[model samples]
Target chain A: MSKVALLLGSLRRPGNGIGIASWLHPVLREGLNDTSSGTAHTGVDVVFVDPTKPPLPLGPIVDGSHVPADIRDPSKHPNPNVREFATFVTSCNGIVVLSPEYNRGYPGELKNTFDHLYWEWHKKPVLLVTYGSSGGANCSALLRSFLGGPLKMQVAEKAVAIKLPKSHSNGSDKAPTQGPAPDWLEQYRPEVLAAVAEFKDLISQQSSS
Target chain B: MSKVALLLGSLRRPGNGIGIASWLHPVLREGLNDTSSGTAHTGVDVVFVDPTKPPLPLGPIVDGSHVPADIRDPSKHPNPNVREFATFVTSCNGIVVLSPEYNRGYPGELKNTFDHLYWEWHKKPVLLVTYGSSGGANCSALLRSFLGGPLKMQVAEKAVAIKLPKSHSNGSDKAPTQGPAPDWLEQYRPEVLAAVAEFKDLISQQSSS
Candidate 1:
């Protein structure tokens, strides 16, 4: 089965980034097969890589390379999360980063996870879905540069940036809450669909080749 | 006494960021008074805010605002480190962030400390000294926007980006190592001095006013 890692990049529990992703998860899952004309997406499963659930450590390597070089592969790494995470990353066909612009850029927690990780992202297509004060425009540019330049990932040309108006926001990017999809999801559904359509096409190409 | 908080923003103990700060500390301390033409800087003390030393938490409020609102003042916060840290931030004349660029951005541990902070950085003059493969330019721009935007801080006109050559870097920003200064210190001393001169003048004005 083809898999896409939906990365939640907000440090906050109920952050708008998570909220948007929460709303879009089902749509993406159901919509993957909805495309009648585009590249055939077969079993394109959308999986979440939420930072808070197990909470990826603040640093790249948990023990900072205390593990012997021989044992540093995916299975034997000292940290269970990193071990599992590396394997999970390689198993995926594509990625979707749902992030919030903290300050003027993306959250460090998100960037921290990708540090020291070189090959896991190789040739994988990425779709950035950002939410913040500036609709996450500034963050989108920086993340694109970093991911494409060093991580060697292919970022989809189309992306979504949801600028939550101050009046509507409850403020914090909280952990995923249980409820119906957030209200704003309907407004941006079309843009997200476009981005995901582009994303799936890229993923389809990667899988075949 | 004019105090400047020299922030070591790298997670690695002997990281390049710490190395540069260590080399620059004594120079900045002694040279703060070396100025003859610019604003008078007296007793300019350069203090190190090394993340690994005490290791600021991976967050702003240690309890994440678990404490009641009334006791949230700098003096009464539940977390001793944060209480003291907030007070320390307020006591400073200016701030110097000595950071290494990680994947085109600043470290999250450093940014996490300032997440909900508002008053501490108000009108504070900040000089960013960045070290990275890109000579720290990309990280510099993102940080400048963040500090100048939500944090309400002033980014100094003169900043330094020391791009350590890959051949020279031991491949990581390790914690500040013991012993004689690293060899590259001498090469960058003059540029370092110029940046500090501008930094000290800003501090001097902030102190005098």
Candidate 2:
């Protein structure tokens, strides 16, 4: 089974990140469970990583000292959170980042998390999932540049963008209670499933090679 | 006299943002005073705006509600910070942004401040000044898009970048006590002065036209 990490980029209680994640999580699970068609496949394992509960203090990362001589060397790093996060990333076969577009870019918190670990992210396949009024096109572009340029991660071509409606209430204090997926989101369900399948295939191919 | 606002994008103590700002501020002042070059120029008034001491709470801006019915109308907005910042932006004949590169992009706080007001930024000529390992090329590109796209601000072609040395120490607690500019920074001094002159010329043309 290929392990996939779903990194949520926002911390707001009723933010669009949670709302989209709530919908994406189930759809992804259903995709993993479906094995009746075509070749038999191992189901995927999914884990959620939230940027709000940062694994390590962002000072070192922001100051550009988070990377050491040997990225996997625990002795060089004292932060347990960084070690744990590094372990999680290295173990994962692929990653899916769900981020809200903030001022035409991804949250700094999310970038901080990525900056904390360097070599652990190299060669891992990543899928970008963004939500916003402009469908997060700009933030997704920026994220792709960072992933491809600095991190050297294998970024998937097919990404998912959930465009929130103009009237969508964001930043409300209430936790997003599970409800029927909106029609707008329902239309994008197939695309999300396709992205998951592609991610799985890419990871499997990389593992075998 | 033309009023120019200098927006500092970094909050880190003894960071590159302050270092570049200190250099640019005086250069800009000298440019404003030097009218003997050719055309008799009006004296320039420079004001420093730090994102660390934000005039308003960032909630409304992050949620994308900072745009008022009439972007120039302060009566429609309830946030006092927005109104105060709006006044500052509108009063300025031009703006100069000095930002430090963080994670291959501009700081979130700087983006948050821009999101807080809309029309106040329209048509205002802007010059980008960035400093970092890669001379903040990526952050400057992103900032240009922001200035040209949503804010509808006029961006100058001439920009200044102060490339920090690899051995430079950032985030030091020691106050950036006045000292001679480092050798690397000294090389970029002429470039900074040229950018300031270009910015003054752009703003002057905009005012007359």
Candidate 3:
């Protein structure tokens, strides 16, 4: 059984990015669940690391947990929240991030989450789900470079973005109320499945290696 | 007189980035103070924005003082931290950001600070002051792209980085004693100064045009 972490970046309620993630969660879960019948067994357990609280810390781990000391002491920390988030990420095999494009990049809070845990983030597989007024295309593209270049995270190619303004409904129901899944979800379902499969395989290989 | 807003990315105490800004503050002040003679007046003021408290709310303002709806019903309003920070940035002629690298990008929290407000960040002139293991090279470069492409910020080419491990010290002092600003600063200072001057001229021209 494999465990997958779902890290939500937005702290706002009724957030467009989170709403999109909610729609896609079942798809990822279903994809993971269906993989078991194949030669490999795939099971994903999702964990959401909330950003409202303090994040993991950097440097040596003092407590019994692999958690850093700064997370426990934010006053002396550059970004305790990011460190704690990194600790959470370290515990997971793979991650799916619900990123919101703000000012044309991943939110500052999300960046802070990574800044605190540089080494722990290396080699992790990340699937980004983004949404913005511009469908977050530019944000997701630039993010690919950062995650791939510096963090050394293996970001899955088949990602999803909910193009805002065009996709959003002006009616009372601003949320995705189109039911089971939107047409766009169906269109990208194959890539999403393939990415998750690759992630599971990578995790399994690393575990054995 | 030129007013430079020093927006310190990391709000932590005794942070090296902050310390560097502190060290440089006097030099800039002296430069400005000393030039206030003969024919012209030269003065510089640097203000730092602290992201620790409740920020002002977003929305249209009638007199640049209050948001009517929020004043009437604070409970119905979204968080205002982003709006307030944007407001501060919009008021400034130029900005100096003391950014620390996180996962090869700016801290998410700091980024979120801007995400919360798009209108205020559209045409601002921003300068980078970053540090990290790689002297925050990748992060700074990526940040420049995001600022220029999405946020539409005029990013100053002149930047600073404090490479780690090599710069690490065993001294008991809380703040790490960093060597002199990287030589890159000298190379980019004129470029950045020109960008700032040009941005200011452009903005003034637009308003008067």
Clashing residue pair totals per candidate (backbone < 3 A): 19, 0, 22
Q: Write model 1 residue lDDT over B1-209, tens digit each, in one string.
A: 77888887775533455567777788667667675736667777888886655535435222432322234366665656766777888888888887777666776666666654556777898988888666778778877888888777878887888878664353434434457765555576777778777877777677667
DockQ for each model: 0.34, 0.19, 0.35
Q: Fraction of true inter-chain Cα contacts (below 8 Å) kept per model?
A: 0.23, 0.09, 0.48
TM-score of each: 0.85, 0.76, 0.72
Q: Mind giving the per-residue lDDT tens digits that candidate 3 earns over A55-91?
A: 4222211121222222443233344544445556667
- Candidate 3: segments with Cα more than 4 A from true spot: A36-39, A48-87, A133-135, A161-173, B30-41, B53-80, B133-135, B157-165, B169-209
**Candidate 2 C-alpha lDDT tens digits along B1-118:** 6788889876655456566677678777777667754234667888877654655334323233333423567445556677777777778889989887766777665776676677
Query: Alpha-carbon error at B85 in model 3, in Å?
Result: 3.2
Candidate 1's C-alpha runs over 4 A off are A35-37, A58-80, A170-179, B35-37, B60-83, B170-176
Q: How would you order the candidates by DockQ, starting with the best?
A: 3, 1, 2
Clashing pairs for model 2 are none
Global fold similarity of model 3 (TM-score): 0.72
Regarding lDDT, does 2 or 3 come out ahead? 2
Each candidate's iRMS in angstroms? 4.1, 5.2, 9.3
TM-score of chain B of 2: 0.87
Best by DockQ: 3
> What TM-score does chain A reach in every model?
0.84, 0.86, 0.73
TM-score of 1: 0.85
Per-residue lDDT value at B160 in model 3: 59
Chain A of model 1 scored by TM-score: 0.84
